[model samples]
Target: MKIITYLFLISFFTLVSCQGNAQKKPKSEQFEIQKTDAEWKNQLTAQQYYVLIKEGTEKPFSSELNKIKNPGTFICAACKHPLFKTKRKFESGTGWPSFDKPIDGGVFYSADNKLGYKRNEVLCAKCGGHLGHVFNDGPPETTGKRYCLNGVAMNFIPTKK
Candidate 1:
């Protein structure tokens, strides 16, 4: 009876330790850091350069994506990392583009913002590029989080028809 009880306690402790280690593991992949502004400019377009590097926002409703409906993957214009998908896109009627969710932890949240209103800012986790702001006001059936992204900051990779 004592042997059975001892074994149970030992197993429980082992399981807990393993779980803790798993939770502590880091998820991001390390990459060679690109360090110069000139290098980024050379790689991205003028609009993409402005938005992704300088943190500028494109004029609202000016993006071609305001009417885009095709299926595709949206990638970071600066780093070419996937950021959002067509299925997550939705109209928030706020002029700029909106999404229900990011491509699985692709974005990291931070305190925004140049505007007077304090808001939660979102950035690309990989390259630390600015994407947009996220708000809680969204369709009830969806994630209930509105990711208001700057279209210039992203490039749409259309799915093959």
Candidate 2:
């Protein structure tokens, strides 16, 4: 019992240390708009940092943009890359802001399973900020895709026309 306990403690601390270092170190070349960890920390708000940098989800219906019905474009908060247009925006009733599709070359995809299930993770192509997940249960009459995004990860650019 003593040996098992000792081994468990050692492994736990080692794992924690490794994860801490990973969070601290920035993969500087991972994105086009590369920034030091300090720069990102300074630029993004606490909520934005959580969702964009740490790949966390904001609370459902917490964003006023979820109810926005204006004519505009949704852009990445981290890099200002235009993602979804007003034409693609829709109410998914999932609480988060949903879009039918992203603009051409505006975003990239990765496979994320941090929640024990495979999901298509969306990120800003310019800054590599985590946007949200993409699911297939969108309105079938259209493209049949739902880009469920974290509101803190994007900003709405209202159109002038």
Candidate 3:
């Protein structure tokens, strides 16, 4: 009887601790723009809704912006926070649009435990929208990092020079 009681208490505490870790999301105070689910749903397309709000990944090589080489800036689809510049873009050959880095403090990082592994998630600091994941596999010359982004999560604004 005592053994059974001890087992139940241990299991309860274990479950509670797991739940606490899962709910440990970044606070809204760190971000500038905050919106309810209804507001974001209305502002974004279905794909944008999935990638930005639901933290989903788009199909690889499916983004038209991946091939673009024009001088411009890519802004967050949700809040128009300028994230990456054309110069930072690179052909990672990973089928996703990759950038060496993001504009200074334009995005923030969060730990995503999806896909059965831990990964750093990049999000717009302004809107807290999921942009994509960052990887260490990138050109060794620059920042030695790759910002693997969902193109649908951003909008490119070409600069007229």
Per lDDT, the best of the predicted structures is 3
What digit string (tens of lDDT, one per residue) describes model 2 on residues 38-155?
8999999999999999888999999988988889999999889998998899999999999988999999887775654578999898898999999999989999999999999999
The total of clashing pairs for model 1 equals 0
TM-score of each: 0.74, 0.82, 0.84
Tens digits of lDDT, candidate 1, 105-140: 678776653553468877787776778899899777
Q: With candidate 1 superimposed using the best TM-score fit, by how many Å does residue 59's alpha carbon deviate from the native?
A: 0.3
lDDT by candidate, in order shown: 0.80, 0.88, 0.90
**lDDT minimum window of 10 residues, candidate 2:** 19-28
Question: Higher-lDDT candidate among 1 and 3?
Answer: 3
Q: Between 1 and 3, whose TM-score is larger? A: 3
**Which residue runs does candidate 1 get wrong by more than 4 Å?**
1-33
Task: Candidate 2: give the clashing pairs.
Answer: none
Candidate 3 on 18-51: residue-level lDDT in tens?
7555565754777888888898899999999999
Candidate 1 root-mean-square deviation in Å: 13.1
lDDT of 3: 0.90
Sort the candidates on TM-score, descending order: 3, 2, 1
For TM-score, candidate 1 versus 2, the one ahead is: 2
